[model samples]
Target: MEDNVKELIEITALVIEVIGILVLVFGTFLAMGRYAFKLQGEDIRSFQKIREEIGRSILLGLEILIAADIIATVVYDAQMEQILKLGLIILIRTFLSFTLEIEIEGKLPWKQEKHRTTGKK
Candidate 1:
């Protein structure tokens, strides 16, 4: 039973890792396709939009990869070492995500300005 559970967790982690890669690949392709097809005269704006979309996909993919890393850590023999390594991995990935978010949105996540919706009749 214990071995079975461990095997299941390892498999789950592998699946999650694959999903993360797929998300990054497909998201990037979709973003580039959209930019190619929906060309606008505003060159800078279009380029920036594609960049932001790609960055967003990277952020999400990193988050998913982090989750897979955590899941994979569960089966490691050296619990303490694995936990420390996982912590470092999470920290680095989190920093990357935050930086990508700032690059995409031009601000920190907490400092985002809420758009007030006006009630138009």
Candidate 2:
């Protein structure tokens, strides 16, 4: 029973990681298509919008990958070394997410929507 549970968790984590990779790849193609369309239409802000969309997709993919890492490390193999590695991975991904959010939104994640809605900063 215990081994079955571990196998299930490992499979789940692998599935999540695969999904993340798919999202990242799909999003890249989508962004590329949009960029090409915008370029043909001579839109001045095409690159900016494309960059923002790509960044958003990457951030989302990173989050999903982080989830997979957590599941693999914590649920499938709860060794101290694995946990520490997971922590470092999570930390780096989190920082990347933060930077991407700022780059795409021009504000911090917590502040972006709030400031837009409230007009306070």
Candidate 3:
């Protein structure tokens, strides 16, 4: 029973990672195609829109990947060293996510909704 649970967790983590990769790739392709179609008319804003769309997709993919890493490490691994490594990985990914969010939105994640609602940057 214990082994079965471990195997299930490992599989689940793998599936999550795969899904993240698929989302990232699909989002990129969709954004590029959409922008390309729009660019036929020489729209200057298309580039910015594409970049924002791609950034959002990447942020989501990174979050999903982080969750997969946590599940694989925390649920299946029993070693303290592995857990510490997982912590570092999660920290780095989180920082990257924050940076990406700021880059894409021109504001911090927490401030984004407020800025949108207030129409203030």
Candidate 4:
């Protein structure tokens, strides 16, 4: 019964992970449409800011999915290999989240306003 319960939990986690992946994919489409359709403003700087925010949201969703995946793997197989893989996934996801957070929050180390005005300088 204990093993059965663990299996069930792993299955649930896998389902949640798959759902997260779908959400991430949909968010990507929304972000892409925002830029491709020019749904925002005539000002490129404003559009760029909107684009960055959308990208960050998508990244956040991906991070959630990665966490779900790691949990599912560990639940299914509590082996050293699975643990290592989970650690690597979490590390990469953390870095992505941190980098995107900095950009979306406009807390970049360098003066980003000038770069936005000058276009990727």
Best by lDDT: 1
The best-first sequence of candidates by lDDT reads: 1, 3, 2, 4
Candidate 2 lDDT by residue in tens digits, 97-117:
889988988877676444677
Work out how many backbone clashes candidate 2 has. Answer: 0
Q: Could you give candidate 4's per-residue lDDT for residues 66-89 as a string of tens digits? A: 768766764656688868877788
Local accuracy of candidate 1 as per-residue lDDT tens digits, 30-77: 899989997534656888889988998999999999999989988888
TM-scores for every candidate against the unseen true structure: 0.83, 0.84, 0.82, 0.68
Question: What's the residue-level lDDT of 90 in candidate 2?
Answer: 92
- Cand. 1 Cα-lDDT: 0.88
Clashes of each: 0, 0, 0, 0
For all predictions, the C-alpha RMSD in Å is 3.5, 2.9, 3.2, 7.1
TM-score of structure candidate 2: 0.84
Model 2, stretches more than 4 Å misplaced? 39-44, 113-121
Worst 10 residues of 3 by lDDT: 38-47
1 or 4, which is superior by TM-score? 1
Full-model lDDT for every candidate: 0.88, 0.84, 0.85, 0.73
> Over the full model, what C-alpha lDDT does candidate 2 score relative to the true structure?
0.84
